[model samples]
Target: MSPHAPVLLNEVLEALAPQAGDVIIDATFGAGGYTRAILKTGATVIALDRDPTVQPHADAVANDYPQTFRLIRTPFSGLAEAFAQSGEAKLDGVVFDIGVSSMQLDQAERGFSFMRDGPLDMRMSDEGVTAADIVNAWDHGPMAHIFKLYGDERQSGRVATAILRRRVERPFERTLDLAEVVEKALGGRRGAPIHPATRVFQALRIAVNDELGELRAGLEAAEATLAPGGRLAVVTFHSLEDRIVKAFLTERTGNAPGGSRHAPTAVETRKPSFTLTFKGAREAGEAETVGNPRARSAKLRAAVRTDAAPWGRIAA
Candidate 1:
């Protein structure tokens, strides 16, 4: 298995500014790359991952640095409740590394890659419905909609129709089967660098795992869990996820629509919940991108929580 290297590591650590004795949350904890780095600063790390496979990694750290790290097998979207239950009312810093890890994509058994042929099982957490389940069982209209909205694929209707037609003959059971269907529907491109099946696979993975919904929930959880002066750093791998992160940060920092005098609200009730650490998104440097090709599309954004009321508490 290829070791999972945390993308834009220097940028994330600098933005988060982990200090000694600080309590930080590693919201993704794929291979404990960020978690391990945070521990070097003598900070206590509360790491969470939806996949149960991360438990052993957390255990390894606990053995070496007892009481410095705690791993919870749950999605980062539930972070606030998880922290509250653990009696950590707030955190000094929080980091979210979004999207599929190199570990998941490189491992053929996990079935997250279009390049590899394996079972059509793309659930981040094994407990959730598999990709095969969605492709084989979901209504045709919803399937097309997911492809259009989530994948942003132009030929969603044709792709969905083809998938449904083939599944009737034999339920989609493997990654190659679905990839072949998508390739046929889209008409294989000879010279294009990106696979024709890429968008379809992404759409299925997003729908099966509810990635966008979980991201919104995770951002809300981060907002509520961050202490005054706390920092939140998020790394997103695609435009769709980056857009959601950008909007969430903008709203929290009071840069939303109606900031001017002509706005509808009579009184602005709350101060800004956060201040932008970096005005706009930051991308991986050329060196980092060259080292890890996946870092090419990664974007990092960060902000520091401001002391404010009403708006400070994230709404359900």
Candidate 2:
């Protein structure tokens, strides 16, 4: 098995069903797990990831599938531009394995996991604001907002308050240092199955990388870049990411609200740009989940583009 162990691998492949001569994009090519699998099906893959650290793995894939694979160092949100530069008019398939990869979490320096003691940096790419920057500088209100909105932490305000109180003595420069403060604030784990700092760390990572914004833009870019009948498969590991994917597919497939009689409103007036591949998101099988704990939270949502032009674009 590949070290990357991409979550929902079989399900994503089923959704994509790449074929010879097909052009696909692995929009979040962490460790090249999906890329390699797609390349084996004879599809030409253009992989995108902003993290510079993935280059070595990208190189390995390129070495084996030299003619069919290319890795671009850019966020998935830039998939449209990457495809445009590839001289390909449109994509046949696009697969996204969303959120931080195991490779990142295992690297202590990445600071994505509170379990690992490292610098507070959590930028997916080399550039941009880091988790330390947010915790050390941002006001309590904004910090708490992100904790609640991004991480869904019920004690966001309390945690933010604790961070503010602690940062005054010295800034949070390490992951464990911040984790300890959050743990203390949450009353020392209280026999929780997971660490008390888990949600806060998740929220911080998402905010530092602008993950939610990137995901939205990436989906739009996929919509715009996929050819009619092209397939899209997105695997999300958390409710926040899953909700965005679910809502995007729902609206794009023309399942938007038609408004009740009391509150008459114009349902999405544009043509449906894509159709859902299945009725609902798919989850990993029990076997897969047992082998890969990360797969337990994975949800795969897929769709196929329609002949209609993308929303906001005039159909030619």
Best candidate (score: lDDT): 2
Q: Per-candidate TM vs. native?
A: 0.95, 0.95
Kindly list the per-residue Cα lDDT of model 1 for residues 131-230, writing each as its tens digit: 9998999988999999999899999999999989998899998898899899989988677788899998998888888898888888888887789999
**Superposed model 2: Cα runs more than 4 Å off:** 260-266, 312-316
Instruction: Report lDDT (CA) for all predictions.
Output: 0.86, 0.90
Model 2: per-residue lDDT, tens digit, 204-310?
A: 99999988888888998998889999999999999988888888887788897767667654445568899889999899898998989999999999999999878
Model 2 worst lDDT window (10 residues): 307-316
Error of 1 at 13 (Å): 0.7
- Residue 34 local lDDT, model 2: 90
Q: What overall lDDT, based on C-alpha atoms, would model 2 receive against the true structure?
A: 0.90
The candidate maximizing TM-score is 2
For model 2, what is the error of residue 14's alpha carbon versus the real structure, in angstroms, after optimal superposition? Answer: 1.3
